[model samples]
Target: MLFSLIAFLGLIAGLLYLATGARPLKWWRPDTLVAHDLRTLPYMLSYPFEAPDSRQNIIFDSASAAASSPSSTTPAPATQNSAGAAAAAAGGVATPPNTPPSASRAGSHAQLVSTPSSASIGTELPGIRAASLDKLVQRLTHHSISDANFAANFLMTYRAFSTPAELLEKLIHRYHVPLTPSSGRGAATYDKDFVHPIQVRVCNVVKLWVKTGYRDFVNNPTLIARLKYFVALMRRTGHEALADAVIKSFDKQAAKFAADEAAAARLAAGQVVSPASGPSSPASSQPGTPRPGTPVAGLPASAPSTPAHGSLATAVAASPAAPTSATSSPAILKTPVSRAMNAHIPSRSPSKEEIIASPIPMMPPSDLVADITSFLNKKQGSATDRMSRYTAMLCSDSLDALEIARQITLVDYELFRAVEPVECLEQAWSKKDKLTRAPNVLAFIKRFNDLSLLVVSCIVLTPDIKARALVLRKFMLIAQALRELQNFNSLVSIVAAMNSSPIHRLRKTMELVPEKVRQQFKAIEDLVGASSNYKQYRTRLHNLDPPCIPYIGVYLSDLTFIEDGNSSKVEGLTNFDKYRRVASVVREIMQYQDTRYNLVAIPAVIKLFSPDVSDELGINEDKAYENSLLCEPRAAS
Candidate 1:
């Protein structure tokens, strides 16, 4: 037993010796040498002493070793003879005369990292025993790679790998794989020789993702983002389609996310889960439709027909009977992922039209309120700016009308900033003939007009643009808002139309208030409504003529005459008698170029009556017709 104990102790000691470098058993250590080398083996090995961090200590070792032993490797000592030669020959390295050469820099480190070249196989390791290979390996750095994987792999590589070509050539031999040489152009192709086996593996990955889980994906954008970079790599270095495949794989992932969410949501909602609809409906079949025999869920295209309508659902419903021939298990399914994943997936969200019609923050307080007012009040001297003032007054909230207002002012300020209205020519061009740019100009005008109406009614109502223009910028709110009193239906419409009409804002202002208001107080409701309607009456309206009310005029604002309801005036109201008289004068003196479009009375008559065409007209037609004729454009009082 004592002898056996000694023998056991001896074996243990031997194993311990093997474990640690009990003796310097190896001729050369690849790893230690590699480490020692990188520390000093950088490319610019021998730089000037003045150079920062010069590797002189590592580089001059060769010369020192030579001095120590005159019989050192290079007996001729030619390498040491050339001192400054390193700058030109070694690309700017300068070894001192007494320092040791870098062992690692001499290519030993590289061999340690990778396989030794064919030239090294016959060469002996400095002192390693072939019998000790196993023991040395135990002490040497254990391969990070598992013995089970790629342990025997013969790497294909070159000592001085200058370009991708050399790398490819080596890889072909090492992997025993064939590859087609690229043409001079270097564009990648999918020829038999060129297709990377790894790429095939990537394709296989894609196939696996699709075969088992196609419908589970909803938003594939993430997947797209991921595979996209790889695919791009392929495009630049490999085949376009392979890159495309990577991109498509991403698309699939994104789609999967979306589908999963949608399906989960439906499942949660107790609704039916179905295969993805095609592109048109997201539920519609996809374009480049797969043939009837195309495989899905690992079922061969020729497999027994499962009804197309519900095959996937049926298979998923029965997890047990589902085929298991796929390369991998279904990716870990989560409860439906967050909605964010559907961002790239098209079908999961609401349609644009639906979104538009839905209530939204489409309206906001008008920021132009003060701006337009300032522009309006700044008017030096011009009636032509009336439209500018008008639009500014009307639509502080409306982008379209304000835009129109902006254009008119911009044109005016740019061309005739200091010029008065009359200085500019009238009836400047042919009717129905727009200047080359006028159509675009007019279209913008129309857009602003349209936007104005919608914006105002938006009930995100702000004060009128004209009032803002006048108040904020000293711009005239052109004219006051068209009254809602009499013919409110056309009031707003008229304002918009007048701006767009051939009549300049200043010229148009003259026609806005009928004489019935200027000389006398009359309810404006009798003739015009809103400025918008006023415009409509001029352009689109018909069958609307002066009513047979004997009232003198229509007063749109305050300070008009009270109706016959009482002898005394009521608070918040006025009378129309004075307008009746002005209506007579206006009827006799003025005539609109287009008589069909003119209002019966002047703007002055607007202050008296409200527009509802109230029962203020006395129960006497003769009196009413007389006044009506007085207000009429073609008739005399």
Candidate 2:
């Protein structure tokens, strides 16, 4: 009787395990249930034993902390696609209380579902499936960035390290707290200093996975889903630059994979897989036959032995047949047919590496000077003609005007890159360091002053009220576009012109300005205003996509503040921190320096508005007074 009782108890335990429908235990049995049923079975088995406080089942106790942070809490509803019962049993994880069910669960499952649920357990056991990769990603929302970083690094050694879907989702879906450092003397000044380290580390890891695990990521449904999620998140969060990089990397990998497969298929089919070559030169003819350039034995003495460099081959290539426009050298004309053939063979587009490696072509000081001279010399057109052309360029699309502004900024960047912080103290240009930075710095000042003059001229010279209003509207548009382009220097210059005493004193003229235009101008003024160290502008720039041009003055101010606040040397030892701090600011400018701006030159537009006069101050108080007097009706004599 005792032996029978023990055997019956063991049989009962086996029945309970089978009822749970665990996948590992059921491997040898013929599977009768679908995946959905299998997932549901475990929940059914646990239902009787589940306690009332099921919310405690989550892998992490984030719910309570999430509830406390009212400002940052935005819990996503639990997804129906989660492993259901098995997931719930794995951890006490439940969807947050009071959240609505996901819209996706609104079909047949909607009828079956009775209660609202919280988010599913993002954590999964190692070696389970792609779901296991999410274990590290789920940690990103942890209170400590270091903890998240540690989890990410430790997970790299796991057999199921990272899935593209899991990585991408983490990048886009994870909770993030904005970095808002205080401006106190003892506190860090930069938002980056306080940013979650997980953001940086995870980015590096994703890039690595994409590079090394290309096959796993390419054409995978899971990765595609992640890519879509990433795009949506970028739009919502305004962190578009990060999303742009990920998408670009994905495209590159896909294209390379396609190319490799095509090559492999050709090779298997016994077709030539070598890169296509251009037509062979005439000189490559068979040795026995009269080679190209070798006179045939039967030819007359007058007949040429070889094709002349400027013969049909060359003339055909120089289609216009104009020597003045074309190069005359024999070397240039050599193998014209081959050169022409190769020209038609379109070259592959430059890869991202090549683009980043290539430097921005520098414009010489002489060329810029010439452009300025031409702008000043040609004052022949009526004010209307000049203003109309300038306004058209300002409103032009595809960032042509903004590109010119950035080119000017590039000049400043190059000249100041090597400038020492100490040189800023020298009022007089006596030191070599000061001289090195002076030209570009001085040119920048001149350029700024010149823009102000142009602004004043536009406002003062337009005699008609309606035309002046139109001119102001264009200037307003230009300012708005500059803000969008992140060209702070030009943005401030435009705003300064509008606020110039001369322009501001036009009380009647200001009234003529449309209310919409005036309101827009005020908004721009507020953005560039010196409140909170230009916090509004900085926030806007952080969200903007690159190939952006920054306002250099802000960076210069940072350098000044750093120098003034900290001593360069402490106790006769070199203060590396001060140097490092200054270098960081400089590096920020450099990152934005050489980005290629896709802009087409509108010479007519550029030449018309190019900086002409380099005078220090163009807002002549007296000239402003004269304009004010002119605008006001004369007192009755």
Give each model a TM-score. 0.16, 0.38
Evaluated with TM-score, which candidate comes out highest?
2
Error of 2 at 308 (Å): 35
Q: How well is each residue in 1-637 modelled by candidate 2, as lDDT tens digits? A: 9999999767754754554333123223212122113323333333221122122221121222122111111222222233322322121222212222212421101101101122212322111111112333433332222232123222222222333454554454332322222123222322233223333434434444453345444335566555444343332333334444445555565554455444333322322111222113121111111001111122122312232111212222222211121111111000001011111111134343333221232222444435444444565576456554444333334334344553343332323322222223322123464434344444444456667677776676566776666667767767776765556776788888888777776777778777987888899999877677777766665544444556656766765665566554443333323333344454345444333333222222333444332232134657655765675654689
lDDT of 1 by residue, 112-196 (tens): 1111222222111111111111111111111111111011111111111122233222221222111222122221332221224
Q: Which candidate wins on lDDT?
A: 2
Error of 1 at 228 (Å): 18
State the weakest 10-residue window (summed lDDT) of model 1: 148-157
Model 1 C-alpha RMSD to native: 34.5
Clashes of 1: 127
Q: Model 2, clash count?
A: 7
Off by over 4 Å in 2: 1-433, 613-621, 633-637
Model 2 lDDT-worst window of ten: 331-340
TM-score of 1: 0.16
